[model samples]
Target: MSEGSTGASVVPATVHLPDDRYIPVRTEDLVAALAREHDAFGELAPRLAHVGEALTRIVSAESGAFSRRIERAYAPFNPDRETVTVGDVGGDRAELAAILAYTFDKANYDLLEDTQVRAAIDSANVHGMKVRVDREKVEELQIFVRGRTQETRLVRTIRRPIVGEMREVELYRRLAVVFRMQNSVEVNIKLFRDIPVADLEALLPHAEAGMSNLDRIKILGGGIGAIGGATWKAAALLVSGTVIAGQYFWALIAGLVGLSVRSVLGYRRAKHLRSSQRTHHLYYQNIANNAGVLDLLVTSIGHEELKETLLAYALLLARGERIDGADALSRAVEAWIARRFHVTLDFDVADALESLDRLGLWADRATMRPLEPEPACARLEQHWRERTTEDYHARTLSQRG
Candidate 1:
């Protein structure tokens, strides 16, 4: 069996399933493995390839419809596109809000929960940059994340600030944030890659880097210390009566002026450091924005749907009799994936079954069985013929008009 990429380790006690729906195995390799394991499927390799192509077409058609809906809803809010002079954006906002959740799910991304958002904001970042977002300014906010992985990252320690130690960190391979400001015309959409969980706040629109308590204490303490030292020196000069009165007054004023300048410079320096950290964090992480994010999401939906359909059909064909119901089929497929590919994932069995049913490949719904390879191929070919015929008629009508 050709091995697939390894996923998160599965422990018997906890039995945690990854939220991501992405399959690590290549489609062709998976088909070949199924054929090798089941001799009945050996001759159906070509048919299986045809099934994949049919499914891809179906997914693409559905994704295109969704893309159109998203585009219409996003037309007014798209930051990259030119502004449209709409009397009221309320309708557009409503449409976008209605479909945003479904769109993210179709794209195989999990919504970041409110609790997770709060945790990210409350926790300190490994990079030591504190960030704050003005929640009142945000009219709408949604964050979607996919492909969670555990990785070791170098984190700066409080004691050893320079040479930080490495620690295990959970990160999202992709993050999409949709933000709309209160009383704003355009909504902002941003896509980022490989974002650390604790640094999610930094990716928020208009997230500002702020001085930490330690930074505040350092600046306040330094200012106080400097003023105290100058005050003591001035008192000594007054008591000794060695310096003239005018000279003493001038020296005290100069000391005060120096202190103010130092304090101002210190604050600016700290502010600059924080701003630089934030800029660097975002520059490396951001991957896409606005209309570009929508394009990527539409493509992801098609790919994920295709993967789900292929896996579900192949499993049903190879082990139809053994699987009794949807739950049983799901478990069977999950076990096979873990055993064959060494990857633990929660197969989206419902969506897979729905696709098969729609394509007329599923035979017994109760048994969760699909049609035999030959019959399945015939059904898929028929679907293609119908789809092409419909397209042709539509094009003819448009041309005639």
Candidate 2:
């Protein structure tokens, strides 16, 4: 099998690639591998190409040799030996969330046949209580546990990602309707790289609508005519030249060929777009197990679309905060506030902001002003310190023994 590009001993698996050769894959490829076929790990590769320069630098370090080369970056990805923990603010939360959520939501929930989120949501609603989570810890996990619903003695946490800016609320709403599944599931994607709460929430509505349309226009659902035309053009090009010039018949062929080329290109664009939506879909479906009565509650209020929109928006709002009151109320509160005052608050609220804080709902602190993001993130200035001090000391002790 292909060796890990990061030079660590490869995980035991069977494949046809050379024992020493590494096959790096795009992050998207890893995601697709899991969604399409979980066991098809051999096909997925780390998106290590961009990091080639970084890897080369590490390999050249005096402490770094062939043994430690590719594995440096790979260390973050290994669950068994984590370089960062939930308490480590600088831990690659987004990637960790993506991989783990898929396991929890898909493998544990769907494929493995464990928790049924729809049922969990219901049980939690009936007997659920809310918990108050630490602000700094929430940043560590990149999730604000809005609230929880206890069912079968299990606390099912409900939450939403905070969209830093209020203006993106509309987008969050749209995303809820189109891609609300992300919220409904159990995977906590603390955050996407550089996709702040505001941008996601702002673009949510459009993203949702567009994704929904895209699904219909591609994948399992789509506009058949558009897709079919593209496929035909692609096929024709594969067999012949981009431009066919010759007989009168060739001129006629040219017209068809033009359509074919355009169609294939369109199909590819649609396919690429479709890939991201699948992640959102599978991700949400996994976490939604405990959305609580929100889904039914919204439906009862005759606001199914609104409710869906709210779910995605809600997750966007509570991304980096902590709300641990028995259930999803904190997250719900965050949603209500966004819907009401259109602002986000931090955990360190003064007594004066009480009414303003509670009026919005959820476990939020009072904002200094609208549009300014509270320092919800847990700073990781000590990451390298901990790496070199704590971990390195432990490694030394272990080796000495």
> Tens-digit lDDT track for model 1 on 208-289?
8887666777887899888888888787777877658559867887988899799889988997898887798689888889
The whole-model C-alpha lDDT of candidate 1 against the native structure comes to 0.71
- Estimated TM-score per prediction? 0.83, 0.20
Clash count, predicted structure 1: 0
Q: Once superposed on the true structure, which residue ranges of model 2 sit more than 4 Å away at CA?
A: 1-115, 118-211, 214-247, 273-401
Give candidate 1 misplaced runs (Cα > 4 Å): 1-18, 24-47, 83-91, 124-126, 217-225, 388-401
**What is the C-alpha lDDT profile of model 2 across 68-111, one tens digit per residue?**
32133224433234344454333453443443332222111111
Model 1, 275: alpha-carbon shift in Å?
1.7
User: For residue 291, what is the lDDT in candidate 1?
Assistant: 85
